[model samples]
Structures are given as C-alpha cells and as structure tokens.
Target: MSQTITQETQTPTVPAAHEAPPRGGKLAGRVAFVTGGTRGIGAAISQALARQGATVASGYAGKTERAQDFLHDLQSAWAGHETEFSIHQGNIGNPEDCRRTIAEVIEKHGRLDILVNNAGITRDRVVSKMSDDDWQQVIDVNLSGAFYLSQAALKHMLERGTGRIVNVSSVIGEMGNIGQANYAASKAGLFGLTKTLAREAAFQLARDGKLDDDTIGVTVNAVTPGYVLTEMVQGVPDKVLDKIKGNIPVHRLARPSEIARVVHFLCADESGFITGQVWGVNGGQDM
Candidate 1:
C-alpha cells in the first residue's frame, strides 16, 4: 500500500529509532562504540547514536584526513546536543589495534554501554577465483574484528550488568550473490557468532531459569542490510544496479540512515528482549 502526506499531517522521521523513549534523551549520558563508523552506513549509525545523547567513539581503519572531516561534520551536526565524539583511527582487524580502540573509549567515556560492529570490507570474487588472502582478509575483519571488540567491551558491560552488541551483517549472507563468496561467508559468520554469543551471555546472566531484570544480560544481534547506496556499491555497473533495483519491490536501494536506524533500535535500552535475531532492512527485497 502506498500513502501520501497532506497538510493535515507531517511525514514521520525516517530514522525514528534515533529517539530513545521514556526520557528527554533516550541514551542520555551513555557511551557507544561504533567501528568503521567514519563513513557510509557506519557514519550514519554513529551520528544517530550521538543525536540520542550517547557519547560516540567512532572508529575507522584509514584515511586520517577523512576521519578529521567526519569528526567535524559529526560534531557540527549535533552541536545543539551535548554529545561528545572522538575518532579511533586503527585497523580493527588487527587484534592489538582493536584492544587499543576499546581501551581508549573506556578510558575517556569511563564506561562502555554499546558496541556496534559495523567494520567490514568486501573482497568480491567468485569462489573458484577468490584468492586465499582475499578470503582471509574479509573473515579477519568482518568476523574476528567483531569478536575482538565484543570480547574487550563485554568485560566492562558484564561488570556494569547491561550492554548492547550489534553486528552489521549483509543480505548477501542470506541470498548468496555472484562474485561475493568471501563477503557472503564473512557475513554469514557474523550471524552465527551473534546467536551463539547471545545464548552464552544469556546463560551466564540467568537466575532461576529466568533472565534477571536487575542484572538481566547483554544483548547480541545482527542487522542485514541489502543494496544500500554506499561506497561498497559504487562498483556495480549502472545496468546491473538498475537490474538489482528492479528486483527489489521498493524500486530503489536503501539509504544508509535507514540501516543505521535499525542498528540504533537494536542498541536502545528497550530492545533487551530482541537479542539473537537478524533484522533485514532490505525494503521488502528479501521477503
């Protein structure tokens, strides 16, 4: 069904999940760590969290100049709010670097409340042609990087008795695409990691067979975004891109902010019971 807005009502906010309900600022005074958050979808997530009053630690793998520009834009965008932003420039795929990134965030923020594993790279190649290095690189960053960050942040969240872990998966993981064997595999690994880790955390926080509200548990979930208009999609030829859009019922690719909103919602305080699930922000494409 299609609908239109008239003067009687205004259009709803596209990224409604940026709001945290029951309080003036939904995530007021909290802390968030967003990896690969300097551009594209990750940047959107970082900004959304910051707008909701969470001090955001934005992580990026490279490009010092761009990181500075991103930080400036982020700060400028949220100047009205008392949101603090910092850039952690390092390759999260590097285990040691991942530790240092989380350490800096905790040291500055004094505590860590949310971890969004949005750091990922694509080494698209057919299975027969994909090099070992390409496969290894994607897995190392998309999978192990999340593991490393979550392991480091979980320690603090456990001590505080609450936390949120949102890993950015992909629709390709669900419906494997041509020349994306490595990418799909890496993302599928995220979904597996998400569910298993959620259950493990849940069991650790279990009391009398029920999750304790006072000390309930940390939640782990994955978001699968399809054909989002980001740098990653620029390689697709216009003809192919149009074909992809034609396949999607919505007739267009998803916006980065739309995916960010889903990630933001998963990290909200009210989304405790919504763990271990894969929310597809594909605009009716996958369904």
Candidate 2:
C-alpha cells in the first residue's frame, strides 16, 4: 500500500493597512513638461498628464491672451485635481528659448520627470514650390526644437537616474503625402532622434551606478497621431477630411484626448520597459 500526499494551497498574503498606500495615478508626484501645449493635441496631452496627478508646465509660442485663456480652461478642467498647471511662452524653434523653457520648468518644479515634444507647425508645399523660409521654419520648430529641449531635459534626468521623453511625430512622415515635403521631412526626423536618444538614455541608465535598482532607467518614445480634430487638421477642407476619414479603418478622425491618453500611458511608471518605440495613435492608417 502506497500513501498519497495531499498538497494544500497556501493562503495569499496581503499587506497590512499600515504597510503602504495603494498606487494612485501612474504619474502621481511626477512633473511633466509639454511644448506647444496651449491648444489642440498639445493641450490635450497636458490635461491628460495633469489628470494623472502630474504637475505640468505647458509651453506655447503665441499671444499672451490665448495662453492665459488656455490656462484658465485647463484649471477649470482640473478643478478638483491636485495636479498643478503652469503656462510658459517661448519659441522652441530658437535654441536659446527652448533651453530656457526647460530650465525654467526645472527651476519652478524642482524636478522634471517627463518631456513631451508636441510642438510642430506644418508648412505644406510641393517640393518644387517650397520656399526656403517655409522649409527652414518647419524644420526649426519641429525637429531642431525637439533636439534642443531634449538635450536640456536629459541633463537633469540623467543626474536623477530616470526620465521619460515623448516626441510627437506624424503619419505623413511615414508615407509622404502630396504637398507636404517639408512637413514630412521634419516629422520623419523625429523617429531617428527618438530611437537614438532612447538607446543613449538606456545605456546611460544602465551605467548610472544603480546596478541593482529596478527604478533607475530612462525611456524615450515617439507618437504618430493620425488625422485628428484639432486646429491643425481642421485646416483641411471638410470634403478632403471626409475623404481621408473614409480611408481610415475606424471611419473617423481620432479625438485629441485619445492621442493624449496614449501619451500619458507611455509616460507612466508601468511603461518603464517600453522604449525606442513609435507608438502610433492613428486609426489603423497605414504608413
């Protein structure tokens, strides 16, 4: 006769009430900086981050009146939130101003946990007809500006041993569209910049003297939002937008909040393992 052994399942262990509080918003206690965050997709990103309990500094290159109004709207939206929002005015296209803005955010917040390079302008024109000013202007703001800001923020982040950077690219960049040569070029450059920075940041984090630290790391990613109902995309004639929508598998343009949600997700602590990715927010639009 052989005796059979019975195994009993162990009871699960739960932390006592005094152990630690449950995690709040993924970005609670974090500070985020967003460029061109006064309106449209940028504003949506700022608001979404704030909703996640992150203090946000929104940079805008425009009139004070609009900036003030945007800030007021953001405050209203976050009436009950502990998140704080501050608006900064500067032209990120200028390296000096771009760096200054990042410096100012760190000065005010005492820390910078995330950076969203969401500022961009489209100077759409056929390659043959594009003017020097148009090409250079878009490039300056969309590509060069991102580089300047990222360089400034990386300094603080590397010192702190962790950070998140999200660059806003475009669907046009992947598949060039008609009359968008300069715009496409500027957006396309973001992909390379994002990937390179992600690699550099990862390497630095690994060597940051925190070999056994699980929380010491940096992540850099890019977002390509498809046609969205923003001031930028609304410039397209309704008929043209309709045709474009028809082509989308979702049969509609993306809401700015939808794109913002993805950005916020990428900036969360849970996304630490995700880096050097081009997270597309398009409605299944190819290329």
Candidate 3:
C-alpha cells in the first residue's frame, strides 16, 4: 500500500547559517563610516549611528589612546545589541589613506551605506597673518579630505544605487569668524562640493539605468552647526564663551549630540529625497 506524504513528514525549512539574522532599528544591517569619529562631535555622530543598529567604522588620524577608550565604551554600551564597532587609524588628508579606509570598511563589513565627513581642523589666523602651511594644512584636512573620502565611497554607493553622505560644516563658514580665514574657506567649499556631488550622483545613476521611482536613492547633504560645547570651544575664555552664547537666540552653546541628531536624520534610509540641502543647526544664530 502506498503511504500518503504528510506535512510533518517533510523537512522544515530553516534560514541558511550564512544568512544574518534580521535585526531591529532603522539602520539594521547598514554600515556607516565616520571620520574623526573618536572625539567631540565626530564621537557623538558615531554613537548616534551605532545606537540605531548600524555597524560603524570610525576613522581617526592620531590619538590611539582616545580611540581605544572610545571603542571600548562603544562596545560595552552596544553589547548584546548585535552591533559591531571598529576604529581605524588614518590621515584623512591623504588620498591613499582615504581610499584604503573605505576599502577596509567594505572588506570587513561587506558594505557601506553611509559616509560622514566629520574630520576637520582649524588654523585660526587672519589672511595677512596666516602662513602658507597653515592655510594648506587646514584646506588639506578640512575640504580636500572630505572630497577624497566622498570620491572613494561614491563608486561603491553608485553601483549599489543607494547611500548617504553628510558633510559637517560650521557656522564660521557662513559668518566668517575672525582669525579663521582658512577654516572658513575650507568649510564654505564644502557647500559647493555637497551640491555638485548631489547632482552628479543622481545624473550618474540615471545614466547607468539605476534610477527609478522605486530605487532607494543616493543623497549628499551638509550640516552647519553653530557654537558647540566641545573641546574646540571649551578652550575659549569664560568671558568670550559667554559673549558667544549671548549672540545665539537659544542663549546656550549646542551639545554635540544635537548636531549628531541632524546627521542621523539626514543619513536615514528614508531621507533619500533630501539631497543637496544645507541644514543650519545654529539656534537661530545664522538667521
């Protein structure tokens, strides 16, 4: 007699061992690369992204001890969340370093979904007093570094047809702070770079037949934060700091986390349509 096959007799289907289990949070399975990610605002941005379930590759130029401490804290805080964190040492000003940083992240994580060009330096001096080296150094690290990293990340992002790039500019770039000419110019350059790259990303994708209504789009944006309470600002004298705060309508310096919030929003997967925009998080300081 032939026996009828039953549902219980069939083998139950199971997820492949190689497949990653589904994770919670908006950025689950996504990877983010943050420059200068061990200190100040950069550190805040790294934490924000990791909290949302993204694997983070934080780049630092120097300060091994600081980066180690940050990595330890991050891993401890994110333990059991299925999130991974890493710190990479590299000078963002070097194109080769920038390219290698991106390559390392891709190799280790298998993908890069977001890029934050947050590494920057300030050579505070008036044009007449600013030495050539000072100007060049600031420009190299602040403006050119962003370009280098963005250029490297763009190739992969475009091919995948999805990505987010957020440039961290400053209010000094817009208002022109005294003794910060080089810094201002470099930051201002980012505005132009951000807008142009935004257009190019879309154009290239369309040309490659990757553009469509249903596709998760690639976007580039800039966030210009006003005076923030970071090490960069803490050095200012109490009287000067008070004066600066008085100018802000909010009457206080911004927390690094506040700036990170804007970045986190811009990098969200749903923020694809919000490209080439300059978000001023200055507590009405600019307007």
Judging by TM-score against the true structure, name the best candidate. 3
lDDT tens readout by residue for model 3, 1-287: 00111001011111122222333378878899999887777887887787677899988888688678778777766656689989898987898999999999999999999999998876666779989998999899899999999999999999999999999988878987767788789889999999999999999999999978888789999999887765455345777777777888999878777988899889888887899999998889988
Model 3: weakest 10-residue lDDT segment is 1-10
Q: Model 1 clash pairs?
A: none
**Model 1 over residues 1-287: C-alpha lDDT tens digits?**
00100000011112233232222367777799998887777877887787677899888877778788778766666656677889898886799999999999999889899999988877766789989998999889888999999888877776677899999988878887778777788788999999988887787666434465554369999998877766555555777778878888999988777888788788888888888999998878778
Which candidate do you rate higher for lDDT, 1 or 2?
2
Candidate 3 lDDT (Cα, 0 to 1) = 0.81
| Most lDDT-accurate candidate | 3
Model 1 CA deviation exceeding 4 Å by range? 1-24, 207-211, 214-216, 231-237
Computed on alpha carbons, the lDDT of every model, listed in order, comes to 0.77, 0.79, 0.81
| TM-score computed on alpha carbons, candidate 3 | 0.90
Off by over 4 Å in 3: 1-24, 231-234
Pairs of colliding residues, candidate 2: none
Q: What is the lDDT of residue 95 in candidate 2?
A: 98
Worst 10 residues of 1 by lDDT: 1-10
TM-score of each: 0.87, 0.88, 0.90
Please rank every candidate by lDDT, starting with the best. 3, 2, 1
lDDT of 3 at 88: 92
